[model samples]
Target: MNKKVFISGSISIKKLPKEAQKSIDNIINKNFEILVGDAKGVDSLVQRYCASRGYYNVKVYSIYDAPRNKISDKFRFEKVEVSESVRRKRESERQQAKDQAMTRDCDYCLVIWNGRSKGSYANILRAKELKKGLKVVINN
Candidate 1:
């Protein structure tokens, strides 16, 4: 079976470095089905790249629809929406759900860490707790 990978990363696109961009490209080229939240920043970049490359199997899970940005129209993806109520709840539960979904659906979780964001840290903890294979891509 083809490997399925969940992509979690800094939403701050402006902070992404050249190395991080290349790493994401490499990962996408490996034919791993990508799972990401289709928000702004790195998520948007990855989704747009996959779409432009004709990667049909990419899936986006987000709390909202595509952001109001100018991503290319060619990027097509399956979207799973997480209800807003989940975000309003306790942080632990939200992180649990995110981790659960990723673990249940993906073979590996690739996290692009930008800095000291709490959400990113929570994801790291969740990945560790689930014992899923993780690849941490640091973009400094």
Candidate 2:
């Protein structure tokens, strides 16, 4: 089976830096299956890049049944089911469930942080706590 990589970053990042693009290119070259979120910012940019390249080995993990932004219909959708209590929490808390699910499912992870996003930092910490292999790129 192809290795699965969770590529994620801060929602505050409006652009994908050269480093991030290069990292993604390396992943694509290795034919890793990508597990990503369905959000604005980095997620959207990542989706667009992969779609532009016609890379269809991507799965958009989301808290809802349908993702908010899936750049291509070719990508699969993975809905991580959370408890009712979690669904009632703040949006960030709810989104974290999907992030955790992606972290659990990935063989490797690439986190692009903008230095101040608590959510992105949380993902980095979660990957560490789970002892998953990961790379972090500080975009800020």
Candidate 3:
């Protein structure tokens, strides 16, 4: 059986860390079910790489009514909603919902992070709270 891997990372990086890319490539064969969000940055980078490689065993979840990248259409999708108060709504909260859902659905997470961004940090924290293992690929 294949493991379900949840992937997330920072938005600030224009280039992915070599270790993170290695981790991604390592998990992307026929033995993995991958999950990722539909947001930009790491999500987009992973999605593009997987799509280009014709990986179909992926789920691209996103918040309701949000436009995702075109390549994400190739995979299955789950539309999510934010529980935050509408009056205080923010895009980050919406993305949090999507990433949180990914956390809940995966056996573990691969955090492609540089150890500073909030979103990637939140994903690591959420996985820790869920008692799921997180393999962090720190920047070199």
Candidate 4:
């Protein structure tokens, strides 16, 4: 079966882990459909590397019409609807809703976190709440 790997992370990480690169690369090479949020940091890095390598089975999930990162024009997207309440809230709240939506349809989630990012921690817990497979890689 084609695995749908959900990717989430902190916005402050400077480098992608080697293990992450290997796992993502393998997913791309094997043609697994990728589901990722359209935030900065880890999301951007993953999208950039995948686009550079011509990996096409990617679906960028976002709350706004446009993603925060520079997502490639070659990929498809899944936009999450922002509620009126969330519209009244902060950007992080809107982003968290998007992450929850993406996680709902994924088979497994790979989180690259620094252990202190609220967004990353929220996504990790959200995955567990939905009973989805969770794999966290603590980034330095």
Top candidate, metric lDDT = 2
The TM-scores, one per candidate, come to 0.71, 0.97, 0.87, 0.93
Q: What TM-score would you give candidate 2 relative to the actual structure?
A: 0.97
Question: What shift in Å separates residue 12 of candidate 3 from its native position after superposition?
Answer: 1.4
Clashing pairs in 1: 51-75
Best by TM-score: 2
Better of 1 and 3 by lDDT: 3
Candidate 3 TM-score, C-alpha based: 0.87
lDDT of every model, 2 decimals? 0.65, 0.93, 0.80, 0.85
Candidate 4, run of 10 with poorest lDDT: 66-75
Please write out the lDDT profile of model 4 over residues 1-140, one tens digit for every residue: 78798988888987889888887887787788889878779888888878888887888998888776656888888889988998888888778888888888898899999989988999899899998888888887
Query: Candidate 2 residues 1-140, lDDT tens each?
Result: 88999999998898889888998999999999999999999999999999998899999999887899999999999989999999899999999999999999998889999999998999999999998889999988
Better of 1 and 4 by lDDT: 4
* Alpha-carbon lDDT of model 2: 0.93
lDDT per residue (tens digit) for residues 3-79 in model 1:
88777776665555666567667767887777766556766776766667667567666433453332544434443
The full ranking of all candidates by TM-score, starting with the best, is: 2, 4, 3, 1
**Weakest ten-residue segment in model 1 by summed lDDT:** 62-71
Residue-level lDDT for 47 in candidate 1: 71
User: Candidate 1's error at 6, in angstroms?
Assistant: 1.1
